[model samples]
Target: MGDVNRATTAAARAPKQDRSRATRQRLLEAAVACLAEHGWAGSTVAVVAERAGVSRGAAQHHFPTREDLFTAAVEHVAEERSTALRELFPQGAAGDRRAVVEEIVTLFTGPVFRAALALWVAASNEEQLRGRVTELEARVGRETHRTAVQLLDADESRPGVRETVQGLLDMARGLGLANLLSDDTARRARVVAQWAALIDAALGAPEDA
Candidate 1:
């Protein structure tokens, strides 16, 4: 009888745990969408709660403040981008490398880029957002440096390697901004290709190779 009661309690708690996880995911995704569409300044708790389809009280229960929500959103976006890159760039058999590179640039030019830029712009006026953005950007830089170092066969501690990684990130950011403000897909793709080739060369991949 005791064992049966314990099993019943465990079964009851399992659904609660799943619901909690789902709620957290919903809030995180809603926060990202809010930040991307409205920028950080406009992404208040009330706004995010509405977007998440939760009560303001419930949202606050998960993320106590707007700053906390924004930070989580940035981290989520960074993780998602990193995961996508890892999946897309599987090892060996470098077939369709150019196309793969293009897809990477497209990801940068999509929602992730918009969300990050919005955070940056909002950070200029908000101290909390500024600090959060700095932390997130540093994490992203480390991730980029790791990938760059692996591809370029250079140590992360090397000066030129850091510069190369930063250059690629900056160029990718610019491509995203250009995509946001322009209607020229052909020109944008050409520019992105040229910039990517430059980074690939720096990574020892070379244009023809």
Candidate 2:
């Protein structure tokens, strides 16, 4: 019984597998909030540590480098936006086309897009963040394209679908920028409606237009 107890104790103390994960999360969330509030120039590892209520050394234990922290932060926010989009759309593979498109547009013109815009702006000024920003973009692009294909009932290999998806992404990005500048929900919806008409025409889907 003593030997068994020792073994259990050893296992319990075994480096706390992934114990740093929560710290990483807190740091990442802090990074995003800091970026949103201060923009890229004011976001520093020390500031993020203070924002997270952790010592700078503790934050460094989780994210050794500022680039790593920013990467994690951008990925976290992107994942959250992706999850929100998934929730807004249908559960099954098959979704209501009109609903999905409108919801997507609304999402793009809302909080998710605003956070992304901040990241984009920050990345534009910081060369170190450029690669991470590109990676985040590629991930979002692939996921968005996959969702669009599934919604449109088009083969991924189809030629026109790629262009359609690109156009939709461009439109969404533009709308997001508009939202940030204008802060007009009604205008954003109207912008989405315009894109909806164009997408409906391109997709040959009658429901949304």
Candidate 3:
């Protein structure tokens, strides 16, 4: 009996596995909140672990490294935001041009974008974070532009059409950043109105025009 017991391995606990995954998710959520609210320096693994109500040892077990944790957290945020965007702006969503533009601007001004901006600023000085941030930014930036173009119902083949769409994304991000330091609300309203009017003129008209 003693020999048999010594040979037995511990069974995999399904509930424990679930709790571990849930803990990891909480850590990621805490990291996002910290990044959005306190910037990169404040989003340490210890801080995230404490915020998630988990031990630092648990955090290290899941992430193994700071870069690993931040990378996974960023990816988690992107996935959540992408899902939200898809649900909010379905494929056939039809609305006023101004309203659509405002919605896109709102998307940029939200917490995910704020978290991304924090990553951007931190990655500038942190070489380890640069590669991951670049990969995510390219993917998210392209998808955002594509979605905005679709919502505008604009002909991308037309001259300068793509540029205009890209400009709108850039403008929204710019406004979001400016909003961090100052209440660029009035300025953003004016810019978005002008951009929406121009898009209406260009896209609402015939492609030949």
Candidate 4:
């Protein structure tokens, strides 16, 4: 329902020049990698600056505090994923809705969601990060549900249909967290199958891809 490139990560930096925009992109990507691999404690501004191959002062110039850097990084990466999801879930019913369900499930269980999950865990206790994460999640959640509903061609006019659509995201994220520490492959597959059934039924599609 929304355009991903409309407010890109680079635009978030308000960069007036190509060089400045490049620097912001570098820092954002480095920050996403570090957050996914090392969690919040390891993703300091100095470390992110070093990883981005930029001076610490430059990082500071872009983001005055550690909180600023990570918060912006969170937003930058989310925008990036939203864009990619838009491409994957393009306009039309190319296949059965099960394919769309599986694709969205795969996205939540992948690296981008992993990084965002790490930030969410840390945000629970960290005041500054908590504020940003809370706001961002609300916006992202709304966009994700709207997009998924559109892809499924679901009848949101039906009762509880909108919430059921969002439930796919919640279910996938719960499964993603479970997979982090253990294989849980067989169980995850079952969960995906069941959720796909529920989603397909809601949208009046048969259980076939």
| All models, RMSD in angstroms | 3.2, 3.7, 4.8, 7.8
TM-score order of candidates, top first: 4, 1, 3, 2
* Runs with alpha carbons beyond 4 Å of true place in candidate 3: 1-17, 205-209
Model 3 residue 162 CA deviation in Å: 1.4
lDDT of 3 by residue, 1-209 (tens): 87666555223466678898899899999888888888888888998899999999999999998878877887788777656665765753454668778888877776777777888899989999998888877887887777777767778888888888888888888888888876777888898899888877766653333
Q: CA lDDT of each candidate? A: 0.72, 0.71, 0.80, 0.79
Clashing pairs in 3: none
User: Which candidate tops lDDT?
Assistant: 3
TM values, all candidates: 0.84, 0.80, 0.83, 0.84
Better of 2 and 4 by lDDT: 4
lDDT by residue for model 2 (90-118), tens: 54224345556676666576554555667
Candidate 4 lDDT over 1-209, as tens digits, reads 24666667548656567788899899988888888889887889988999999999988999998777876887787777767777875664445677777777776776677778888999998887888889988888787777777777777777878788878888878888887777777987887888787777776642233
lDDT of 1 by residue, 1-209 (tens): 99999999999999999988888788888888887887766889898888888889988888998888878877887788777676766652143434545665676787767787888888888776787788878988788556544443444454465686667667667778888866657987787678766655554542234
Candidate 2 wrong stretches, greater than 4 Å: 1-19, 90-95, 110-112, 157-159, 205-209
lDDT over C-alpha atoms for residue 107 of model 2: 56
RMSD versus native structure for model 1: 3.2
